[model samples]
Each structure stands twice: as structure tokens, then as C-alpha cells.
Target: MNADTPMIDTTAMQRIGGQLGTNPAGIFQDGNGRRYYVKTLESPAHARNELIAAKLYQLAGAPTLTYINTKAPEQIATEWVELDKKCIAHLSESERKQAQQWFAVHAWTANWDAAGFNGDNQGVVNGKVLTLDVGGALAFRAQGDPKGKAFGIRVDELDVLRSDDGNPHAIKLFADMNADDIKQAIMVVVQIPDEKMRRVIIDNGGSHALAEKMIARKADMAGR
Candidate 1:
């Protein structure tokens, strides 16, 4: 991020080494005194993929750490949500529904890295389950997973590469979602206009090819 980025404060920061990954990351405060987690990435695709995932989560209106677009492609930042260490196994009916919403959006985003309920990103904020750290989502792939299937269900089959180590509880939550609910999440993702998507992608140092691929996938899902 440049010095001119007025909203973010780079002066007051806390290193989060060994907690998030090998990336050089820390939590920084914003002008409004809210803390946000920012990772200084070396790959543009890695950064873009995570930012896209953040936008996807925001579009779904699921309980997730809010992603803020950075001026540099090597930086991915999100509003740090203060959450308890408790996992999502135990929750009330309403909270469970919110967790299910997160599951649907997670699958919709094809998150290959962060495991929603099973992994370390699992936390409870205000009795709501939220997941963070999406650097391996979107365009990233898991072993043995076929390419050209980044989004949507194809021919009644869906890949399981969305999670690194999906747990039984997480699997059950995703399976419990009716088709309609999943569709609602996808609908939210496809609602972003093509021009806006292009701008967001290009502004963040993503290639036009990536933007076109995302739009084509969105168009395919919309047509179906």
C-alpha cells in the first residue's frame, strides 16, 4: 500500500507470523481505529484470488471478515474481526443457519485453502461463525482436481477441492443446505456487473484474462 492510502494506517501494526502462513502479514489499524489483517503477498494471482473471494463473501452477505481492496497487487487486506476461539460445532438455530450460509458461499467461491469449520480460521463473533484467510481460493487448485471448473456444479457432480481437510461437521453443514439456498449464494455472486468486475480486477493488478475467465464462469452459471 502507498503512503497516500488515507483509510489504512500502516504505522500501528502487529506482526502475525506463524499464525497466518509464510507470508509477511500483520494486523493494522484503520483511520476509524478498526484493526484489519493485511498480508503482503508476492504473487498477483494469489492476492487477486483472495480479494475476489472476499468480494464473493461480501456479496453473499455471509458472516465473514470484510475484505478491503488494496492499491498494490502484492497486498491482501481484510477487516480483522474479533472472534472467540470456539469452533462452529455448537450453535443456536439462527447461528447454525448463518454457518450454513457461509458453507454455501465457501463452496461457491471454491476455496481450496481455508477450511471453514474444521481449520484454524474458524471462530465465533457475536455468536456467528466467520472464516478468514482466502489466499488459496478462487483460482487455486487442489491435487487431482481438474481444471476449468472454478465455479458452479457441473453435470450433477461437484469437486471436493474446496477445502484442504474438510471435516464431518463441515461436510454435514454443506450437505444440509438445500439447492435453493446454494443457488441464492451463486445468484449474489453473479450479480456483480461485468464492467465493475473488470475494473476491480484491473485496478488490483489482475490480468484481463483472469477477469474474462471469471465473467465467463459467471455467465455460464447465470445461463443455467
Candidate 2:
């Protein structure tokens, strides 16, 4: 599950949820089944950077994700621990406590020392009182993290809270990603074929629009 692993043929991955504006590569299983997503290396340098970032997060013991190497196309696969819908809805007080515990651990390793913190989130899942997005705690400010000093921490936080509010998570995660390596890890995924047929999203300095353009271009080539 390290960066050195091979890529998977994620084309066979069943799309459970609608694509989010943030992580265009976003894929999920229903609240019932295991979810999996595959990311490919569109460009060599970006892929290496992303792989390094992922590996660094892992090394830090962050609860980010397991990066499986699907070398077939230089793709990366992520884990899918599916939560029960019913469980996600009626989150027990104990669940909230656990969420707080997780938050503390996340904050510590994720360099809460450098980045600032946010309000304790009301864990709502699927429109219910579930453990939604957790670690959105921004740094003291939105200063750019171009060298990715804060990316491993922030991106790990976002991945840990994906099912909470995937769309919002996607947006926030992309913003963070842009600050780190916009042209590399974030923008490179625009090469995903068949994504262009979808409507273009406008946000985060036209990141989504750029994704749409890539998708559209692929669609055009497929037609030709």
C-alpha cells in the first residue's frame, strides 16, 4: 500500500456517488459497501510528487489513506472503509467522543502546532448526526503552502473526513492542494478520460473549470 506499489485498473470501479467539484477523481461505494478510488499519474513529475506526499503522510502515522500502487498505468488506489448508513445517521454520543479523540490525534500529528484550529464539528453524516468532516482546522491564516510543508497534514485531515461532506471536503482539499502543488497533483488528474462530458464547475481560481476543460478535450479526442 505504499507509493512503490503498482496502479490499478480503476476504470472498472463502480461509481456510487456523483462527482465532486473538489476531487474529480472521487469515487465511492454506498454506505453499505466498501469504497475504492484509483488515481493515475498523468505526468511523471507530478506523480512522483503526489507519491512522495502520500508516503510522507503515511510515515507520519496520519489516518489519511492506504496508497496501493496499480502500476498498470501508473495509478494509485486508495482505501474505502464504508460506514453503515444507519450507523452514520444515529451517531451515538460515544461516536462523537471517538470523533473528538480522533480529532485530537489528527491535530497533533498533523502539526496543529503550525496550523491553527477550527470549531469542534457537529458530526453529521448523510444529513444526520454523524461524524461528518473532521479536520478542516486551518492554520493561523490561509497563507500559501507552496513547498507542501502543510499539505501532508491538511490533505490527510481532508481524506479522513471525506464521507462527512464529500463536496465541501473536495473543495477545501483542492484549495489546500492548489496552495501546495496546483499544477502537479491537483491539476494533473484533469487527464481522466470520460470526465469531460460532465458540467464544468467554477471555483478555486478555475481549478474545476480546468478539470472540465481536460475532460472536454478527452471527449473530443474520443469522438475523433
Candidate 3:
């Protein structure tokens, strides 16, 4: 866990809803009375992916939810926000820049579930856009994994090399991202300590090979 990652007491949590999608997630109130969206995965690898991605986004200066690692394995609590849809035209220049930087960083992490792209996994807080879910990142399939055949699944190299499409807002935001902006985003990944990264990989059943591949992908994005 990152030194800054919050630790939540699961014993005080109160579930607020049914399962979300295939993952068992619920809206809950913590001991302090703060509400959060908690998601629990069956795979340790997936939980680790979500936590690391959230931390990377924070380092990259992107708008993201506060991610906390609960006592239970495969579970995490994210700061809650009201879901809303506001067109790009409604965003101010600063918000637009933040959104673009977020897209660049998301691309660096090979995250395909970003909101306003292919999924409704985003929410607005104080008129700024924040990513609500980042669990679908850094995925590596072993031989014979069925997800490998899924259409539109983004791999590390492909995400680094691909251009934004389908979402007009994302396309416009990315258009404003210069090479330097991309390099800064990639540098965030480079700044993460190796020991912390290794723990995340090993504890989550992820291979060192995948971690190295992701680092290389960040390098490729920086060069692009």
C-alpha cells in the first residue's frame, strides 16, 4: 500500500445497494459518516490494479477519487461523487486541461474503462471530471484466457500507440495534449518507487513481467 492510502474499517460499513455489474460493489458510509463507493473483486490482481492506477492518477495531477484499501482482500473504498453528465462545452479551460491530462495518464496505464469513452464510469465533483473506476487496467492474460478475444480490449502497446476516437470530448481533449504533456504523465510512473510497485505486483498475483511491460509502455508513450 502507498503510505498515503487510507485504511477503512470494514466492520463499520453499511451496504447501500445491490451488486454493480459483475463486481460486488455497494455504496456505504464509513465510520466517520462519509459516504463511499466500495467495490470488491474476486481477483486480487484486479484489486491491486485499481489501487495502483488510482495512485498513479494522483501523481500525474489528474482528478481522481480517493482510493482506500480496506482490511478485506479484493476490496477498496473510493470517495463518493454524484454522477452527472455535462457536455465538454460546459467545462472551463482549467477543467478541460485537467481532463486532457487525465486522458493521457489513463492511456499510459492502458485503462479502457474511462468515462465518456466506452463506459459510464465517471462523475462530476465541484464541476470537475473525475474517473470513478480504474479496475480494468494493467491486465495481462495467461494463455487460453477468454478476455484476450474480447473486442475493443486495450493492450499496453496498443493503448500507447492508439489515437482517441468515438468520444468527441476525449478526442478534443487529447488534441490539446502536446508531447511535453505526455512526457510529464509518463514521468509520474517513472517516479513511483520500484519496491512499492513490486509489492503491488507480487501481492496481487501479477507477474514482474507485466510490471516491466507497463513501464516500457510508459516509455513508449513518452517518446511518442
Predicted structure with the largest lDDT when compared to the true one = 3
Candidate that would win on TM-score: 3
Query: Candidate 3's residue-wise lDDT over 46-110, tens digit each?
Result: 67667776665665566777776687777867776665644555566776666655665667665
- TM-score of candidate 2 against the unseen true structure: 0.35
Candidates by lDDT, descending order: 3, 1, 2
lDDT of each: 0.58, 0.35, 0.60
Per residue, candidate 1 scores C-alpha lDDT tens digits across 1-224 of 32354444355444442335556777776556667777777576667666666665665576567666565666777777666654556555676566655554455455644354354555677766777566555666422233465443431212252222344545544555667866775676567777886766676556788677667666665665
What lDDT does model 3 reach? Answer: 0.60
RMSD of 1: 4.9
Q: Report the number of backbone clashes for model 2.
A: 13
Q: What is the TM-score of each candidate against the true structure?
A: 0.67, 0.35, 0.68
Off by over 4 Å in 3: 1-12, 17-22, 82-90, 116-119, 140-169, 172-206
For model 2, the superposed segments whose C-alpha errors exceed 4 Å read 2-6, 11-21, 26-35, 39-65, 72-76, 85-90, 109-224
Candidate ranking (TM-score, best to worst): 3, 1, 2
Q: C-alpha displacement of 91 in model 3, angstroms?
A: 3.5
